[model samples]
Target: MVPHQCLGSVWSRRNRPGNEHVAPTVRATIAQFNVVASCIITTCLGDPSMTAQDRAVVVGHWIRVAKACQILGNYSSLRAILEALQSVSIHCLQRTWDNVSRKSF
Candidate 1:
């Protein structure tokens, strides 16, 4: 999935084939999961072995989680997403944008 648009797509996919438990408790669990997931992604992005494309993939996953939490109607989760997004380096955002800007596939 595309980096910037990853979340919306993930949410849409989840809406179609979601776990029954994943939906109802999603609102309640989203905030904590978002933070944990964001931290993990942030750490992954910082791995010295990861390439630019790999970093972009990690950022895309964070975007997906953010989108999912937002669509779940969890305000705390949304806040966490905002914080995570801020924590993401500007270079990462630019890389995501660059990836998007050049897509012809």
Candidate 2:
């Protein structure tokens, strides 16, 4: 089965009637999504020790990973990664963003 279809099936199962409690699979999926997003944001901004250039490199790496996710039809991951990159903390890093290559934009 396609990746999205598999995820959709798992997600749909969670919303079915009489499923009073959340399924473990669904919960795990949600957690994984949140983790991916959080990790991206943290990697970009969590370390005060990282230089602007270093942060820019990390941002570029995540962007490339997001593009790969898009190509693989993993919209859930792509959305999470994009949202992280656009989060307030990461978005406000002017120096880091300036260090990012124009080609990356």
Candidate 3:
């Protein structure tokens, strides 16, 4: 096991913007993150009666979210985006500062 943190290592995508690859990566990251976050956050915010398996599922789900957020963007409002990201519990998905996600698109 890579400690669940290695998956969040930022992938350096070069020339992606010029090739229109950036948009899809961003969109995919957001979409995937949203989906995984929904599952994990829902179970997490739900009853304390959740089983150990449910908690494990949430932990794995958050790892997916972290990996998605690891896909970086080179837009102008990076600072604002980062701040906004901090507002969400998804920030814990990465378990480290391995990703620099934006709050604002």
Off by over 4 Å in 3: 1-42, 72-105
lDDT of 2 by residue, 7-67 (tens): 6655576667875354565576678889999999988888889999999999999999999
**Over 4 Å off in model 2, which ranges?**
1-20, 23-26
**Candidate 1 Cα outliers beyond 4 Å, as residue runs:** 1-41, 88-93, 100-105
**Arranged by TM-score, best first:** 2, 1, 3
Candidate 3 per-residue C-alpha lDDT over 1-105 given as tens digits, one digit per residue, 9 for 90 to 100: 123222333234423466444345555555655664454555554666755555445545444454555565533233333433454654554532333223311
Task: Please write out the lDDT profile of model 1 over residues 1-105, one tens digit for every residue.
Answer: 234333554445444554433334444456575766467546655577776567666656656766777788876765765666566563455655455323211
Clashing pairs in 1: none
Q: Rate the local accuracy (lDDT) of all candidates.
A: 0.56, 0.85, 0.45
Clashes of each: 0, 0, 2
Ranking by lDDT: 2, 1, 3
Q: List RMSD in Å for every model shown.
A: 13.5, 4.6, 14.7
> Where is model 1 poorest over a 10-residue stretch in terms of lDDT?
96-105
lDDT pick, better of 2 and 3: 2
Name the lDDT value of residue 64 in candidate 3. Answer: 49
Number of the top-ranking candidate, with lDDT as the measure: 2
